[model samples]
Each structure stands twice: as C-alpha cells, then as structure tokens.
Target: MKLTRRLFVGASAASAASLSAPMVMGQARPRVVVVGGGSGGATAARYIAKDSQGAIDVTLVEPSREYYTCYFSNLYLGGFRELDSLAHGYGTLASEYGINVVHDWAVGVDREARTVSLAGGATLPYDRLILSPGIDFVDGAVPGWDLSAQDVMPHAYKAGTQTALLKAQVQAMPEGGVFAMVAPPNPYRCPPGPYERVSMVAHMLKANNPTAKILIVDPKESFSKQGLFEEGWQKHYTGMIDRIGPDFGATNVEVRPDTMEVLIDGVAEKVDVCNVIPAQKAGRICELAGITDGNWAPVIPHTMQSRIDENIHVLGDASAQGDMPKSGFSANSQAKVAAMAVRGALTGSQVFPARFSNTCWSLIATDDGVKVGASYEATDEKIASVEGFVSQTGEDAALRKQTYEESIGWYNGIVADMFG
Candidate 1:
C-alpha cells in the first residue's frame, strides 16, 4: 500500500489505541527527547511522533525559534535564494505531529537517569534520546582567530546573521579588492561546502565587482569535485579565483581580524573580507554527554545508536558513521532508519534493515549545477557505500539546468518532510 501522510497519521492513531491497554495497566507511554531541530533532529521527532500515533511522547529541545539551513546559505550569498527562504519554524511539528517543542538550550545530559537538562532549569526524561547538534569549530584551529573574531571574519557556517554579514562584506568590498577564504580541514561538515561558497562568492563578484579577486587558502591538497570546480571557475570566472594548497603553506595559517591580514607561512596579505571556516568537531553537547570520542560521536551503523550508550542515538554531522558525508540529506535519511528502530524498540513495531542515500548538489554559476551522490547499506562494520555517481565535466547546459531545478525541488520536499 502507498503510504501517505494521512494514512500514516491514521496508522499511528490505531497503534496508540492498541497500546492504550498497557497504559491502563499503569505503564507509561514511551518518551523520546530530541536535542537539536535541524534536518536530523526535526525529522526524527516528527516521524517518531507521527508514526507512533501518540504512543510515544516526543520532545524537541532547540535553542532557536527559527532554523536557517546551512545547506543553501551559499546560494543566499550568490543571490540565488533569499534569507527568509532558508528559515523554517517548528510550529508545524508541534501542531501537526503532536510534538512538544521546547525553545531552550540543552545544556547537559544525564545518561544514567535518561534525562536532559535545559537552560530553562527543566529536566526532560526520555526512554530514548536523539542528538543531532550539528558542527562546532575547534578552538585555536586557526591561530589568532576565535569565536570573538567571528564578526570580523564571519564563518557563516551556522547560517543566520553570520550569513548576512559575510554577504554584506563581499558586496561592500572595494573595487578589485581581495576576498579571502580560510577553508577547513578534512572530516568537516559538508565536504564540498567551502568550495561551493567560493563558487557562489565568485558568482556574486562577477556580477557586481567584476574586478574583485577571491583567494582560497585550503589545508587539503585536493577537494571534493575539484576538477569540476576548477573547470567551472575557469569557464565562468577566469582569473577571479586563486587557490593555495598545503604545499604553499595553506595549512599553517593565521588570521588577524584587527588588521584584516592573513598570514600564510610567514607571508601576510591584507584582504578586504576574510571568511575563516575553522576545523570542526561535533557540537558541544555531545562532549557534555560523554558520548563523543573527543571529536565525533560513534554510532552503530544499522540503528544509529550511540556506541557508548545504546539508549541514546546520534545522527547527522555529529555522528561518525563511516562512508557517509555529513550532509542534510544523509542526516534526514539516517533519521528515518533511527525512527524505525526507536519505534520498534519502544512500541513493538516492526524493524527493518537500514538503507541510506545522499546527494550533494552545488551550483557553479547561473543554471550551471553539478552533483555527487551515493547509496549505502548498513554493514556489520559500517554504513558502506554501495554505489555512487558524479556529474561529469562537459555536461550540456540543459542537463546542468535540469540538475539545478532538481535541487530546488529537493529543498522543498526535504523541508516539508522535516517540518511536517
């Protein structure tokens, strides 16, 4: 049978009625507390609540009232999307799916008691916990730069005011001024994100400040879709973007926000705007919960359960699941598998084997899109990639434009799946 949202809601209600017998016997309903309400956390909360038919009580703990997706913030920088278009509210999740949406910071977690402490001084107890706190920058990852200097050199990775700040900095650059980007190392959020931002920055400059130049100081010798990006840069914005790899001392770099100068291997260059994306690790709450292995939280591939605590699950960028790049699509996909597992564990629902998929689409210029994608299945050891595909160089413009359109459709669909 084709499962629609209405049908799922009905099924959930039926399940809840059947489970009422246990509640009448003095047993409590299963409780799930989700921390972070982005692609992973929101989807997990919605699915568990909607599919369980009120058999499970789900609480979502997020500090922000509105979430701005980091996925398409680069497009906002390029003027392809509006800032408001990237923002979403949790009202639908609460009103439609019967979720308890709490707007507060999740400050701590007590695994022993299965409770989450909030900044508002309330403690939420849960039978299962899902943590998808996203990415946080490492301290001292880039010398002379820290969170305090973010105003001067905006990371814009979290996608809100910082995104607007970076865009303003780029647009406000002097004629022929330099825009510098300090790219992060490997194992960061969105493997292709920094490069995509560079592309969008180039696109913006080409239209506004045609003479402006973009400099990339990258730690890695190579990057995701490097060939495709270079080809697009040369074709679309020739001589506009220059990259310095680690061989040229990209790894050993320091930023002086006070002076607007970046030191690359003892050589300093003054830039009109600096975008420093530092080395990243799992969000702070993971460390607080003692579930992370110093950087990222490890999880069982099939269930996305924490390796340290089976009752707590980790999803999205915070999870160190093998072979899956930390993308929103990956997080959303993992959330479904986790939701099913959590339901089965809590409500005696049927559990299915886990399968996952991801696609990362990046726009190089107007109507010029490229993509990389893969499908995976859970193995005894990890989430192994079964097959993959990438956009080839020299693809016709029609295909590229079609690819761009597909990405837009995906954005709408995924957000609906997450919020509703």
Candidate 2:
C-alpha cells in the first residue's frame, strides 16, 4: 500500500531489466538455492525471487512446513497470544513469489559442485547458496544436561518442540511451586529472550498461582534490559522474581534431571519446573558442511558471503558477524543485504553499502514491556553501530505500556513482511 524511500530506491536499482533480463532473453535462469526457511532464508528467497521476475530460479530448502517465530513466543507462554498466530506457512513464498519451497532438510553441501544435498536424497544445484539454519545447542556444556534430560529440563530456546514442552510443564506446576530458568552464556540466540520468557511466564504465575516464584540462574552478572526488566518484575510480580548472576553463584550450578533438581554451588534444590538454555553453536548443517568454527560461521560483513567459501552466504544465529547479536530482527535485516549482494554477484553488478537495524522487545506483564535496539552500518569492512537505542530504564509506567503496544505492532509487521 505504501513504500519507503529506501525500499523504492532498492526496487528501482534492482529491477528485473537491470539484473536478469539478459538471462531471460537467452532462455536461461541462474539458480539460487537457500537453506533454512526461517527469517533470513525466507526474506532472501522472497525478495530475490520478486526482484528477478523469472530470471532467477529460487529454491528454498527447509525441514518444517510451518515456521514458529521466537520473537513473540513469550506472549504465547503468558496466554496473551495463540500459537497459531505465530505459525506461518510458505504457500505465499511459492505461489506469489514463485519460490520453490522444498520441505526437506539439507544434509550436505557440495561447494565444489555448487549443489546442496537434501535429506530426502534430492540434490539441488545452485550458482549461489545461502544458509541460515539457525543455532544448535552445545550438548552437555553444563554437566548432567543432555537430550534425555531435556524432557525434565526444557530449553524452549529454539521455538518449536522446546516451546511446547516448556509450556506444558509450566501449566502442570502446582500453585506456590518453583519455576527455575537457567539462562545461557552470552552471545546466545535472542539475547533478551530468556529474560522476556521469565517475565511472561511470571505473569501467568501471578494470575494463576500468586505464591509461585521464579528463580533465574544467569551465567552473566548483567544482561540486556536488566534495569528495565527488573523494574517491571518488581512492579508486576511484587518481588516474586529472584535473579542470581555469575558473581552470585550461577556458574557453579549443575542440573540433575534424574531427580528433577538443580544444584547451585553443590546445594541441590528440587523444583516443580526447570528450563535450561544451554550454550549454542551454528546449526548442524553448517558443521556438516564444514563452514563454521567453534559455534559460528565467519562471513564478510556487508555481503554475508562465507569467508571460507565465497559462493556461500550464511545468516541468522549461524553467522559470527561482528557486533551483531543473534536475534530475529538481525537475521531479517542481514537477509535483505545478503539477497541484494547475491543478486549483484549473479548479474556482474556491484554490491551496495548497507545499514542494518535490530530491536528486541520483552513484556514484563500484560501491558508492560521493555526493549533494546540499535541501528548499524558497515564501517570500511566491518558491521558497526550508528546509534545507541534502548527503552526507558527504572520504573516508567506509561513508557512501558507504550512499548508493550508497540511490540505487538512490530510483530505483526515483521511476520507479514516475511511470509505475507
């Protein structure tokens, strides 16, 4: 219905005639295969397919039929939103944008051949490949925390099975029971997520179990929106929340799932509910492809093209780009830049300089919210910040309410832009 100046300029500069008309006239199209249909992959697939206008064959490979976004998953836990509202289908990606949506996981990547091997045994060849498979948990980073133990201690970090598992456990907890959450170390997916989750779940507990308490065991001494979240927790939960940072003996905690207990500094405590968000790395697909080091794949800042393999680009939690946190907004923004770069590369054009934006919102209660954000631009060769942005800290009632409402609007607009 409307267009921003940036979008208009991007559209004009990336017209079909400018990028793909030659191939169409020659009766051939360059193939671009994208792995992972989350924020990064979906946005790139849609934009490139739309811009190419039949001159670029876009194939998207993902395992899930429907995507569940983690951005507002906390609202679902608080009973403020339905899960169906967060689930988006890829039909529009196929029918409207002409993207070939393949519901399958990519098991192997052949960089030499420029082909991606699917778990279903199908091979999709591409001139350029984009991978945004998200994060994978580092198993057993915390002693006694593993796959089977996840049944008793759900992470709920990845937003699918984990989300459902945690919700069920929270619903079953008795009134006045303890709900303990172990926040992961820094540089984890959705930096403000675990705190937001505690807030939403605490809201539910306050309504149904006024005596319930939330124990947050965090690896770091401080976190994003710490003051804002603490203020909201105090205002709404009446000090029912307790936070133990690393300095306060959080790192010394160990999980004992067999007994449904967590030990802080060797003092075992049983809880009715337990959620452990462990350390994470690039999703297994990147590891299988041998494109990542430690927990992330290194890539060029503006282009997002893999430094290990120039033809491949990685985004989302899977990439270790400088100074960028692993959040949905970051992934989505990087996807746009990566897509433009891919198109430019395919058509022998120059990649433009780009800026990116990210904002994370956390609800402290039904009508109160906290947030942090930043506007970033490329600096010479690295991604750097252009402005400082954060929500009002320390007990502002009206601003909190405004941020809560704004969070809803932001969620609606982001999902629509990605899937609609």
Candidate 1's residue-wise lDDT over 127-191, tens digit each? 89999999999999999999999999999999999999999999999999999999999999899
The candidate 1 region of ten consecutive residues with least summed lDDT is 19-28
Per residue, candidate 2 scores C-alpha lDDT tens digits across 154-244 of 8888777778889889988998899999889978999888988998899888888889989998889788888888877877888789988
lDDT of each model, Cα atoms only? 0.93, 0.84
> What is the total number of backbone clashes in candidate 2?
0
Superposed Cα deviation of residue 69, candidate 2 (Å): 0.4
Model 2 local distance difference test score: 0.84
Q: Distance from true position, residue 222, model 2, in Å?
A: 1.0
* TM-score attained by model 2: 0.92
Superpose all Cα atoms of candidate 2 onto the true structure and report the RMSD in Å to 1 decimal: 5.4
Question: TM-score for every candidate vs. truth?
Answer: 0.95, 0.92
lDDT of 1: 0.93
